[model samples]
Structures are given as C-alpha cells and as structure tokens.
Target: MKVSDLDVPELLDVITKAISPVIFKGIDQDSSPHLWRERMKLHAEIVGRITAVLHCGDEVGPDIGEIIEICTRNMRAGYEQSFSEVLGPGGSLSKIRKP
Candidate 1:
C-alpha cells in the first residue's frame, strides 16, 4: 500500500503494530509529540519512496524481504536520535531543537 494512502493514525498504528514487540525494549512512554510526529513523517516518506521504486519493478525494491529490512533499518536509524532523546534522563526532548 502507498504510505500516503494511510492517515497519521493509521500510519502510527502500522508502525506500532510492526514494532510492538520491540517497543518495551527501549521506547519511552514520555516521548514528545514533536519528535513522535517527525518520526512518523519520516517513516511515511521512506515508505512511499520504497513503494514507488517497487512498483516500478526495480529488482532490489521488488523483493519484499529486502524491502522490509531496508524500511526497518531506515526507520530505526532515523528515529534513533529522537528515541534516545525522549528516553534519556530528565525526560528531555532536546533532539527536537531547531536546526
């Protein structure tokens, strides 16, 4: 499915469901709204790009197994800083600072 086809809530649900088992491992319950929103936006962008490549029959992109791995890797890396910031001491959202 195209990532744009899913709304914010649906996207969040998909992400949460996909990573549910791993959430408790390190996710911060106090995650900030801004960071969470950015993470989700990044996730959707990546998903959409990957989907477009797959639909074009790109060899590497057409592989579901590899696609999932790429998506997960990209998302994890993209959110690492945000996740760490939220989960860090003093319950800070420092990672959301302006560029």
Candidate 2:
C-alpha cells in the first residue's frame, strides 16, 4: 500500500523510525544542518523505494523499523563524505562583515 493508504499513526511511526538514527547521528554528533537536510532527503527517497518494494511483494516478514534499519545500514556503506563549513560559527550572518 502507498503512504496515502496508511493511518496517521502508522505513517508517523514509519517516518520517525526511518529518520531517528539520522537525527541522533547528526544532532548528538554535531553534524551540520546541511548534512542533516541531505540525510532527510536521502531518507525520503530510500523509504519510498522500500515501501514500494513491500507493496509489490507478498512478503510481510519484517517490521517497518527492521526494514528501515536494514536499508539505512546498507545505504551508509556507500555514502560519500561531505563537509559543511559555517562562515561564522556562532555569529549571525548580519554580524559577519566582509573584510
């Protein structure tokens, strides 16, 4: 079934479980907001594919959390490294005057 067919609670549970690890990895580890945004975008893409796979297959073997965990664990194996540099670590954009 499509995400539209899911109840609100089911959708929330699926989305939350899919993205929770990314939040923890980004927030608690001091990862940049840019990286977090990319992670969220990747999550939406992967989850959509996985959900479609489930819909097409007759398998009901895994819970949503388990499936998400498997997908993320595998995806991370091929993730490329990228860095985000903050121009002013703690300063507002308006406060950073060009020299």
TM for candidate 1 is: 0.35
lDDT of 1 by residue, 1-99 (tens): 554444655555575567544433333545565556555555645554554344334244446666666665665666665665654555464444554
TM-score: model 2 vs. ground truth = 0.36
lDDT of 2 by residue, 37-92 (tens): 46655765575546544543455555656666665655444332222223135423
Q: CA lDDT of 50 in candidate 1?
A: 51
For candidate 1, what is the lDDT? Answer: 0.53
Which runs in model 2 stand beyond 4 Å of their true positions? 1-12, 15-19, 22-24, 28-31, 57-99
How high is the lDDT of residue 90 in model 1? 50
Which candidate number maximizes TM-score? 2
Model 1 stretches with alpha carbons more than 4 Å out? 1-22, 25-62, 89-99
- Assess every candidate by TM-score: 0.35, 0.36
